[model samples]
Target chain A: MPFRHLLLSLACFIVFSCKNETTPAPSKATSQRPDPHSLADPFNDKMLELQLKLKVDFDKKILSGSASWSFDRKEKTNEIIFDTDNLTNRKSDPWERRNPNHLYARTP
Target chain B: MTLGKEETPTTFTLEPRDSILGSALRIKLSPNTNYLTIHYSTLPEAAALGWMDASMTAGKKRPFLFTQGQAILSRTWFPCVDSPSSRFTYAAEIETPDGMMALMSAKNPQQVSPDGMYKFEMDKPVPPYLVALAVGDISFQPIGKRTGIYAEPSMLKKAAWEFADMEKMVETAEGLYGPYDWGRYDVLVLPTGFPFGGMENPILTFATPTVITGDRSLVSLVAHELAHSWSGNLVTNATWDDFWMNEGFTVYFERRIMEALYGAEYVEMLAQLEFWELEDEVRAFGEKNPDTHLKGNLKGRNPDDGVGDIAYQKGASFLLMLERLTDRNKWDEFLKNWFQANKFTSKTTEDFLAYLKTDYLEKHGLTANVDEWVYGPGIPANCPRPNSTKLAIAEKAATNIVNAIPATKEWTPHEWVHFVRNLPKKTTVETLKKLDSQFNLTNSGNAEIRCAWYDTAIRRGYVKEILPQVEEFLVGIGRRRFLMPVYTALKETGHVEDARRIFTKAKPGYHAVSYGSIEQLLK
Candidate 1:
C-alpha cells in the first residue's frame, strides 16, 4: 500500500512540474507595453455626471455660479478641470468660441 | 478645535463628504462648528446683498469696493479654497429677500413675479474665484441678438450701443476656434470701481465702470473678456501656481480677437507696449524680490494684480515665441487641437506642457523647452523669431516717412524737426530727455514739427508733467480733429484733476465726443 501511494504522489508531482515547464515566461516587451488607446481623462479616469448653477446680474455687473460634480475614481491622474459656465448669459459669436469646464489631476 | 502634538508626526485623515470627486481630500482637519459649511463656487460675501442697513458699514460709501468690500473680504467670508487649480462644480440655494434678484453661473434666466423675487439657474460647473453676485436695481437693453443689462436704469441705452460689437466678435471668434459650447453671452454693468480689471465670469462678465467708453471703443476690454471665454472660462488652470495659464492664454486670445477686429499694426503696437509693460512689472517686482509666481504677488493685492501686464506681456510673448518656433499653421493647429482636447476642463502648466510637448511639439518638430520659458524666471533669451516680416514693415513705414518729407517741409524745417527726424535708430530715456530741451514750440516751428516734438515727449514719459504745453499744441489744432487712439491714450494718461483744469481753460474748443468721453472716465 505504501509503495502504491508513493508512486501516485510521484505521478502527481511529475504532472505539476511538466505543466509548469510548458508555460512560457512573460516577455519583456509585453510587461513594458501600456495600451496607447487608453487615454486618461484630463480630470480623472472616472467618468461621472456634474451639475452646475450660474447666476448673472447684467445690471450690477455681477456673475457667479454654483456647481456639484459627480465623478467616480477609476485611476489617479495629475489634475482635474472645471468650466466657468457663466458665459451662458452672454450672446454668442462665431470668432470667440464658447468656454468649457476642465480638470487636471494632481502631479507629484 | 483642540490640538495635540505627536512625536511621530500626526497621521493625516480625509473625510470628503462634500467633495465632488468621490470624497477626495488632501489634508486632515478636525470638524468644528466655527468652520463655515461652504458650498459651490462663488465670491465670498459676509453679508447678504439687500437693504440690511446694519450690514452696510462705513466702507460702503466707497465706489465699488476700491478700498474694502465683500469681494476683498472673500477670505473672511469663506474658508477660501484659493487654489484656481482645484476646479469643481458647486450647487447652492441662496435664500435672500423675496423681491431681490439672485444670479450665479450659467443659468436659465429668471422671471420676476409680483413678489419681487428672482431666481436664476446655471447648470454649468465653475470655480470658486469666478463666482460672483450683484444686487441692485438694474435695467436691460436689447440692442442686438444678445441682451445687455445695466445696473443703472439710465445707462441701459448706452450699454446696448457700446456692446453692439459683441455678436460680431463672438461669431468671428467661434469661426476661428470651435463653436462656443456655452450658449449665450452677457455683461453686468455694475457701479464704478470694480476692484479688479474685469472678472470674466463664464457667460456673464463683471466689468469696471472705467472700461465703459460710452463711445464703445472700450470694445478691446470686451474682446479681452470675451477671449477669456475660451482661455479662462473654458480651459481653467489647475492651481493658482499656474496663474500664467489663465492670464497668459487669455491675454494671447484677447490680442488675437483684437487683431481680428483692428489692423495688425495696431495689434503689433499693443503687443510691443504690452511686452514693455511686462518688463516694467518684472523690474518692480524684481526690486522687492525675484519670485515672479503670480500667486505670491496677487495675495492681498487688488483683483487687477491677478491680471497685470506680466500675464499679458510675458504670456503673449511666450505664445508669440511659440508661434515663431512652430510656424503659423502649426501653431494654429496646435491651439485648435489643445482647445478641442481640453475643452470644459481644468488643467495645469505641467499638463499643458506635457500634452503639447508630446502631441504637438514632438510630432511637429519643435522644442520641448517650453518650461525654460514658462517655469523659469525672466524671458527666454534668443527667442525664435517669425522672420523679419514685422520689422521690414515697420522699417518701410519709417522709410516712407523719412523719404516723403516733402521738399518744402524738409530743409526749411525747425531745428527740433531736424533733431528728431535725424534721431538714431534707438534713443535711451536719458538721451530722449536731453533732446526734449532742444524743442521749443514757442519758436517759429510748423505744425508737423510741433506735433513730432509732442509725440517724442509723450513717448519719453514727459507728457503728463508737461501736460499744459502738450494741451497748448493740441488745443491749437482743435483736439476734436485728432485721431481717437492718440486722444484716448492722452486722456488716459492725463490726471483727472489736471484734465479738469485744462478742459476748463479751453472748454469751448473741446470736442463734444472727446469731452463727454473724458467726463465719463473721470467720473
Candidate 2:
C-alpha cells in the first residue's frame, strides 16, 4: 500500500512541474539607477535592434508608424520602458510565437 | 503590442507626462519576450521635426521635411530609450510622397524610389538621437568617390561648389583619426529653417542653407560636423551633463582638420574667435556659475540650456590645454586609441577621466590641473590663450577706424567678423554710418559677417539704418545661433516691440527648437 502511495505522489509532482514550465510566473519589477533625463531602465532590458515602418503625412503633419524593437532582458524584469513625447495612437503588441504572420519578418 | 515571435497580446501604460522629460511608456513582457512593437504617430508640432511648405524651400516648388534629434528631442518623435547610453541598430521603411527623395542617417539611396517606399539600415549601433531623416525634392552630386552634396535642384550647384573640398576633408580627417567609420561623408543642405548650424547625423549631416556662402569660407562648419563622426557619434556622452565630451572633443578635432587644410594661422583665428565667444559667455553667466563648469549639473533643466560655449569652446580649450602639456605625437596616439577603444559606446566625464588616468596620464607619469579645468567654475589659470596675428590686425583696424583711419578692404571673412565684433562701444552713429558706407555691411551676403555686423549695429543704436535688413535676416534665416543674439539685442536695446513684430512674422518659418526659445524671450 505504501509503495502505491509513493507512486501516486511521484505522479502528482511530475504533473505540477510540467504545469509550472508551461505557465511562467509573472516577473517582478527591477530597479536601476535611472538616467536623469529619461525614465528608461536600459540596464535591466536593453534594446538591441529596431525596425520601423512609418508613413510621412504632409497634410496632417505627422508620422504614423509601428516601431518593432528587439531587446535583451538582462534580468527577470516585468517591463521595458521607452521615452516618448507628443506621440499619439500608441498600441503595444507583445510577440506571439504561434502567429506565423507575426514572425520576425520585415514589412513588405 | 506584440512580444517575441508568437505575437502575443501585451499590456502597456503611458505614464504621467512631465513638463520637461516628457512621457515614459512602460510595457509588460513575458519571461521569454525579446521583441515588442509599438504603433504610434507623432504630433504635427513634434519638437524634433520641422515640416515646411513649398514656400519655405529654395525651389519653392515642393514641400520639405527634416528632423533635428539632438539633446532630448528625439523622444518627441519616436518611442525609444532616448538616453544617450541606450544604443541600437535600426532598419526603417519610410514611405513618402511619390517623386520626393527620402534619406536617413543610414545607407542612403542617391535617387528617389519609384513606389515612394524607401528602406534604410544602420548596421552600427547608434544613440537614438543620431537617427535622422529628411524628405524633399532633393538631388545629389558626388564631390568624390565617398563624398557628396544633397540639396534642392536649384541650390545643388552652389552647394557643391561651396563644399568643393569635402572629399579632401574626409581624407584629412581619416589621416588624423583611425578612419571615417561611417562609410560616406555627405551633407544634406536643408532649407533656411534649419535651426542649428549643422547636425552630425552619422553618414548624412543635416546642414543649414546659410552655410553655403558661395565663398567656401564657412566649410569649417563642415569640418566641425565631420569631426563628430569620431567624437560625438562614435563615442557619445552618456548624459547631457557630460555634453562637453561630445562638443569639446569635436571642436578640438575640427581645429586640427582646419589646421591640416588651411594652415595654423587660419586655425588660430578660428580658435581666437571661439575664445572671445567663451569670454563673453563667462561674463554673461557670471564667472562663478556652476553652468560655466565643463561638466555641468543639468539634473532638472532642459539639456538645450547646456548647448553653449561652455560645452563647445571651454571643452575644446580643456583638450587644447592637455595637448599643450603633452607631446603632439603622444597626444595623437592616445586620442586614436581612445576612439578605437570606445567606438560605438557612450561615456561619461568620469569614464573619460578614469581612462585618462589609466592610459594617458599614468603612462606619461604626468600630473595636470584637470580638476580646476573641469570641476571648478570659469576658465582656469592654465587655460591656453590662442593668439592670432590676423585678429590683432583687425583689432588695430577697429581702433583706427574710430580715429578716422579707413578700414582695409582686403580682409577675409574671419577678419571682417573680428573687425565688426571689436567696434568701439562708445562710437557714435556717424562712425557706424562711415563703417557701413565703406563695408556695405547692410548688404553683406556672408551670414556670419551679417550676423556680427547686425549685433554691433543693434547695440550701437544703428537699428534704423539696418532695420530692413534685420527684418529680412530675421525672417529669412532660422539658424538659432544668428537669431538669438539679434533678437536679444533688439529686446535689450528697448526694441521689444520691434523684436515682437519681426518674430511674429518669422515664427512660422522657424523650427520649434528655434521658436521655443524666442517665444520665451518675447514673453
What CAPRI grade goes to candidate 1?
incorrect
Give lDDT per model, in order. Answer: 0.46, 0.85
Per residue, candidate 1 scores C-alpha lDDT tens digits across B1-523 of: 1111210111111121111111122221122101111122222221212121211211233122111112222221222233343344544444333444444445524333345444544455554456555544444555446545544555566666777888877877776667776677777665432333456776777664444545454467778888887887788866444567787877777878888877676566556545654677778777334355432233222332354555566776787777777567778778878888887777867788888788777888777457566656665675432232443443343344434322222222323343444444444445555444433432222444555555555554556555666566444333332322234445565644655565565444332334544556556
Q: TM-score for candidate 2, please give it.
A: 0.91
Model 2 chain B is weakest, by summed lDDT over 10 consecutive residues, at B1-10
lDDT per residue (tens digit) for residues A49-101 in model 1: 23333343323433333233344443432233222111111122221122111
- Give residue B23's lDDT in candidate 2 (0 to 100): 68
Interface RMSD of each: 23.2, 12.9
Candidate 2: tens digits of C-alpha lDDT, residues B1-523: 3333344445555555566776677666656667767767787868899999888889998889999888888888888888899999999999999999999999999987999999999999999899899999999999999999999999999999999999999999889989889899899999999999999999999999999988888999999999999999999999888999999999999999999999999999999999999999999999999989999787767788899999999999999888877798888989999999999999999999998888888899878888888898999988999999989998888877767755477888989999888888987788888888878987898999999999998899899878999999999989999999899999999999999999999988899988988999989
Q: Residue B201 deviation, candidate 1, in Å?
A: 0.8
Calculate DockQ per candidate and list them. 0.03, 0.24
Candidate 2 residue B259 Cα shift, in angstroms, is 0.3
- TM-score of the second chain, each candidate in turn, equals 0.61, 0.97
RMSD of each: 19.6, 8.9
